[model samples]
Target: MIAATRELPAAGYAPEVDGRLKAEFTTRLRQAGGEELKRRFPMLRIRIYDAQTHAREEI
Candidate 1:
């Protein structure tokens, strides 16, 4: 995923690459579950301000 993000500087996409990354990220997050995530990637943080309002959390 970092590789694709890095590619942003070398090229362009009309629809945007962020959406693609977001989907893959969200899927992986769902697969990881809450406890596994907290234990495996402790340093990382994710706070969704729209936990209620938004249809989906914004990571």
Candidate 2:
């Protein structure tokens, strides 16, 4: 698994906040042909985790 950590402001820990990051990341990935890359490498996945709440979501 690939893991990343970022220190966010209190309000930045909300789902909408994280979701926006996910959306933007996904958009950039897709623009860079992430779909084709994923097809070639099926194990690739993007996930988000909240450190404060210890919550996780796959995007």
TM-score of each: 0.27, 0.28
- Report, for every candidate in turn, its global Cα lDDT versus the true structure: 0.32, 0.41
Per residue, candidate 1 scores C-alpha lDDT tens digits across 26-48 of 22244245335446766655332
Q: Candidate 1's error at 14, in angstroms?
A: 23
lDDT of 2 at 43: 70
In model 1, what lDDT does residue 52 have? 27
Candidate 1 deviant stretches above 4 angstroms: 1-21, 24-32, 48-52, 55-59
Q: For model 1, what is the error of residue 40's alpha carbon versus the real structure, in angstroms, after optimal superposition? A: 0.7
For candidate 1, give the lDDT of residue 18: 24
> Candidate 2 has which clashing residue pairs, if any?
none
